[model samples]
Target chain A: MAEEAAVGCARPTGGPVGEENQNETLQSQETLKEERSMIKVGQKAPDFIAPGYHKGAFVNVKLSDYLGKWVLLCFYPGDFTFV
Target chain B: MSIDSMFVHKMWNDHELEHMVKGGIPYPMLSDAGGKVGTVYGVYDENAGVEARGRFIIDPDGVVQGYEVLTPPVGRNVNETFRQLQAFQLVRETKGGEATPSGWRPGKKTLKPGINLVGKVWKEWKTTDAFD
Candidate 1:
């Protein structure tokens, strides 16, 4: 819609452009924030017992195995060059 | 190249593994072959055949102390991860008595609220204050 385009252009940073836009933007942002807030701080992390290829062998790595150590569980979009 | 073949060989090839090791990637890069982990984490993009870039700082007790999930287009900052670790470390050292604000750095002033305290802590903060 032209109105949406105007709003998009007016707010290049994707924030609310006007009073009318504020309500819609806030709603949309809240939905997104909720979806992104899946994991919470100081909560028990989801455990997993999965096979990981380490040193050319399939090894079973479990969340419980790394107990008492800070674990940085990272998920990357694919392995190769596509970021 | 096909996704299956990419997963079979190129995903965890020696050269890539060596490069990651040399680059000082401390943690193991686990492959989410069947997208199960990614699916559970809500980062799996089925059409893309990959998970969205995300990071979780799990504490020693297996609890997720901090979590950050960025959109694919916006890459994560590695240094920020270290900063988060340091912040968490500081908080642990100080017990559950204090919390760091945005852009808070280690060895910097921390907030300790009292009954009489009002407004932002930084506004009345003094350089010579004991908490600083």
Candidate 2:
């Protein structure tokens, strides 16, 4: 998913970090696996806090931050992988 | 949102900035590598390990008003998305007094949604209307 998301929008940062980063990402995925659920229309969308890339900087953004404004939650596969 | 890390996003932006003289990614691309965000939106293909392209329009009250998920092979049109947004806003502002017809644009005539409008849209909207 990470690779696919990358390809949908921006290219990958560099070549590859190493084993440590891979393990870390996998670990996070494992932790989130249990929380997956089907979100429904008219239901309250889940709130999330994640790092976002904007204007060449990494900013910590949260879904709650856009409370009063309409939000277009777009999800892509990876940064640089094939779409 | 994407599954790539912030580091990768930064790199992508840097590359785009260097190469593309005009226009960059306008919105903040959230990183959901853990797949948490995708899971919530139900766009994550757990086995395929990728999120099918998904677009959700959330109202100010945090409700999911509209959404669509397409296969990864296809891309979405930004102009259409913006048009949809405007339609939603227009309807909301009018307090359901009017509704945008198909191919509706800003400043165009809008239909008055009601039981009578179900089949008489063509008659209600004249040929001169932009939707026609």
Native contacts present in each candidate (fraction): 0.49, 0.80
Across residues B13-132, which tens digit of lDDT does each residue of candidate 1 receive? Answer: 565666757633334446567666666666665545656677889888888888787656567888889888988877777785676666667767666656555666757465455332
TM-score of each: 0.67, 0.74
The local distance difference test score of each candidate is 0.63, 0.77
Best by DockQ: 2
State the DockQ of every prediction: 0.23, 0.42
Total clashes in model 1, counting residue pairs 3 or more apart in sequence or in different chains: 0
**What tens-digit string does per-residue lDDT give for candidate 2 at A1-83?**
44543333323244345566777789888866776656888788888899888876778898888989999988876765454
Residue pairs of candidate 1 with colliding backbone atoms = none
**DockQ of candidate 2, scored on C-alphas against the true complex (2 decimals):** 0.42
Give chain B TM-scores in order.
0.71, 0.82
RMSD of candidate 1 to true structure, Å? 10.6
- Model 2 Cα shift for residue B14 (angstroms): 1.0
What fraction of native interface contacts does model 1 preserve? 0.49
